[model samples]
Target: MTLLLAGVTLVSAFGSSFQYGYNVSVINSPAVFMQEFYNETYFDRNGIPMESSFQKLLWSLTVSMFPLGGFFGSLMVGPLVNKCGRKGTLLINNIFSIVPAILMGTSKVAKTFEVIILSRIIVGICAGLSSNVVPMYLGEMSPKNLRGAVGVVPQLFITIGILIAQILGLSNILGNLEGWPVLLGLTGIPAVVELLLLPFFPESPRYLLIQKGNEEQARQALKRLRGWDDVDDEIKEMCREDQSEKLDGRLSVFNLCTFQALRWQLISIIVMMMGQQLSGVNAIFYYTDEIFKSAGVNENNVQYVTVGIGAVNVFMTCVAVFIIESLGRRLLLLAGFGICCVSCAVLTMALNLQATVSWMQYLSIACVIAYIIGHAIGASPIPFVMITEMFLQSSRPAAFMVGGSVHWLSNFTVGLVFLYMVEGLGAYCFLVFCAICLVTFIYIFIIVPETKGKTFMEINQSMAKRNKVEIQMDKEKLNDFQTAAETPKKKEEAHSTSVL
Candidate 1:
């Protein structure tokens, strides 16, 4: 990769995806302190101590609002990227981060827990935008040969962010009453760094060429990104895509869902994204301390153990980054979900028998770590990369909006429901995750194709069978459809009739 390309990937992922992981885990460390602050604030306000149930409700909102805000942010992707361009949208998104940092940093002094809750929503919006846009931006800027590796970088940074949060959350660090605000506000630093450094990098060449029709500018950007003089071949490849999609314009989410040609591509992303969240990885991340306590670890040592799992998560994700290109996306996914399925089943058994079998507690810890390994390898990173690969330029943004929505919605569902499942099913709650992982594994093994070393068009063509549509592989036959579609003078009418 060119220095410019590498720089872009690192900065973008750190600013955006990193924050997603940070906020997800940061809440865990400060929970007791924040809840104390909330109850104290309420007592001062009402001249009496707050009720436990209401305080619990407030805490639940604080944790859940991030994903809720993420859903709203996903809705904004289609319009923002279309109007601002990928780089421009990311630049503007820093506002979400900086604003929340200020709100959260000052919230303690203000003696209002509501500010922190609101800040979570705002930061969640930033996370949502970053999670969708960074991957889309990285996927577009990367060459096909390096795409899988480049795509995995965002996920790697996410794991790093999670680990950093875990470490800083230690009592010796920022996980205390005085330090919590600073811990919460630290998310803004990456955004500021990205804002300063990212402007120096070039925008996506495909965005410049395909979306804006700026051929010369696209050539310059591609040359800068590729660190080479010869870009005509890549430019021509983009031109063909632009021509193919000229009649389609940019697809709205409605068109994306309705279009028969992209059916499986849409379904694949939805299923993958849903599976990513619903596979219970976040449940493990969210409840790691509790799980360790149940497994007979001392209360004092559970935080250390949580940090260890976070470290293991970072290590496994790094392994995924190095190996993704060599191993291909499909095999990694199969292996990841397969590992998770077995791990979840084993964890359930261990949890059930831990009181009787002394060693079962150790086995439960192993299962949790193994499940993290399974998730990091394939399930976490591949869905975002696949969204970029599955659709052409015209539909990519809408696809992200849809995929990101399902991702966040499923995330919110897990955060909302997993606690209930624990209440109702006890150890058997993990069996639900096992079932999810198994079904997702079967679906991927049977349906999803390996996208290594292929162009966007090639990937789409390969999906035709599962989508149950005939792809016109010949250039002339494709042009004939474009011609018939463009025959009418009204462009909107032409798109409506032709793309259908």
Candidate 2:
């Protein structure tokens, strides 16, 4: 039963990873194709070539639109996951993926830019749902010991998908204007697979116990997860935790206008996610061609080299999965941030000294690759993992929504502003990102807690300890209740003994 549950998790995690890859990779090689399609279909219709500024604007809009759609999808995911359960939520999201892929593919073949944008938006929404639910599901379902590693699986798979897309995009057979549709459409395959398989997987026992208040179902689910019938103690402990907290539906952001704990959690997650975006990973992913072009690479070969970037991302993510469990989350985050900061600084310096030596181009590429490696190891998995783990069952969905919203918003901002920054800020943009990384390192060092090998409830208790006043108050309240309840029983036992 344990093996069966593990297998289901692996399948779900891989599906989520595939979604990440499909959503990200579809745009990679299609930039040129998209630009050409837009120019021929729209610009030429007006009998004028689009200006460079407009071209850049159009490109940024197309890219940013997906993240914007993601923002809405993320907001929806929290409630849906709360009500529908993880498996149902993920399966439904696949429908979003399938429909968009079909629309985007059809639009590309038909040369309809409007349809393409709409399709991408739909796909983005689907990706957003997967993004929010996948981490939450994985974190909730995994063993306490294996949680970090299992959580990192989605990140690893995302990189794999990115690499696969990059390679496929570079294929002479598929790397053309016509091939863009096929690339966009391929995402549907994994979505379909996930939708079909998810129904067979068990819902999260913790979610069921806490959210739905179904102890019997939760125990049955736990039995499956632990592969044993002797789960009564475990189930009782879970129930104790669940019952300790009042089912105040007022836990949501909408109900509680001022929740200090929830506020801090949201801020921390937002800062972490924003830091990840401001680190400029997306700039590298989306504009590898332009970056290479600026560095004196042959424009024709930029597509192939971009594939190398994707490969590096995937490789580093795999390394992270191994080390995340061993070295721990905080350490990995610090290491990744440190590497990215140094790499970004070096890239800035290289660009600034471009007039002095030809080697600067190589140095710039190395720096970008280093940044990717750093991101794959650190920022990629940590934010998602931390956000999901930080909150209790009741507050988790809302926390995820806030985090996912910030992440997508930041991604949209970066995607929209990157081209302009490159053109206007020139080499200084790398310096900006370097500064962000340095700040992120400090923030994680001071604020983030190590959740390695800890259960979700344990982590919550640790976090509550940070605020001594609140902790003391809550403890006193709990102690008072226990004392009051036991006093009656003590009196009754003494009276019975006296009568004997």
Candidate 3:
């Protein structure tokens, strides 16, 4: 890949996708401080301390609001990318990040926990858009050969962001009462860097050519991205897909829901997104300290162990970035969920027996790390890449909206209910996640195809068999038309040869 391509990926991932991971884990370390702040604020306002149950309810809303905002942001994906273009949408999304960062930074001084909660929602919107748009932008800008690796960059950065947050949230750093607001506010810095650097990069060539019908502009962008002028084959692929989708124009979310041809593609994305979230990965991130504590780790040492878990997550996702192209999407997903399923069962056993068996606590910790490895390799990144691969340009944005909505909604459900699940089910909670992993593994093994080196059209063709549709007949018809157009020329050449 060209330096320019690498630069774009790094910048975009740092500014956009990083926030998703950072925010997910940042709250975990500062949970006690923030809840105390909330109670103190309430006491000052009402001349009495808040009740414990109400404080827990308020905290749940504070955490859950992020994903709730994410759902709203997902709804906006169809319209924003269709109108502003992917690069532009990403640029505009910085507003959501920067504004909230300021509010959150001053939330402590203002003595209003409400500002912090509101800021989470706004930042969540930023995460929502970035989580969808970054992959779409990267998928469109990258050459076909590099698409898988480049698409994984966002997930890699997300892991990095989580690690950074975990490190900063250490007691000596920002996890304490005085430093928590600054930790929350630091999410804006990447957004500022992106807004300054991203405009210099080109828009997605596919978006330019297919959506706007600007052939020369698309050619220029493609040449810049590819670092060569020979982008004709790529352009032709875009043109063919564009022509095929011309009648549909840009599909709206409503159209995606009702369209018969994309039924399986839609179902596939929804299932992947739901599985990605509901499989209990985010629950781990959100409640790592508690999980480790429950597993019998010393209270003082839990924060360090949590940071170690974040490091494992980053390392494994980095490993995935290198291996994704080689192993392909399907196999990695199967392996990831399979590992997670077994780890969940083992973790349950370990957590249950930790009091009875002294070494079982160590086993529980090992199981959690193994689960991170399983999730980081495939479950985290592949679904985002598949969303970009699974749909044609006209329907791609709408498909993202649908998939993203399912992703965030499932995330919201998990974040909201997981505390209660921990209370009610105890060691059995992970078994629920294990079942989700098992079902997801079976579904992927049966239904998902290898999308490692396929074009959007090629991927669609592969799905047609499972969808029970004749989508490839359009390509066959196009081929037949080209053959017919060439027949008369052949006849003329033959006659000249005979006359001579």
**TM-score of each model, in listed order:** 0.94, 0.88, 0.93
Residue range 178-282, candidate 1, lDDT tens digits:
999899989899989998999998888899978886656787898999999777667666766776676667899999999998988888899899889999998
* Regions of model 2 farther than 4 Å from truth: 39-58, 109-111, 247-250, 255-257, 290-298, 469-500
lDDT of 3 by residue, 92-206 (tens): 9999999999999999999999988888899999989999999999998887678888999999999999899989998899999899999999999999999999999999988
Better of 1 and 3 by TM-score: 1
Query: How many residue pairs in model 3 have overlapping backbones?
Result: 0
**Weakest 10 consecutive residues, lDDT, candidate 3?**
491-500
- Which structure is stronger by lDDT: 1 or 3? 1
Please tell me which predicted candidate would have the highest lDDT against the true structure. Answer: 1
Instruction: Give the alpha-carbon lDDT of every model.
Output: 0.88, 0.76, 0.86
Looking at candidate 2, the ten consecutive residues that score lowest on lDDT are 491-500
- Each candidate structure's count of clashing pairs: 0, 0, 0
Best by TM-score: 1
- Scored by lDDT, model 2 comes in at 0.76
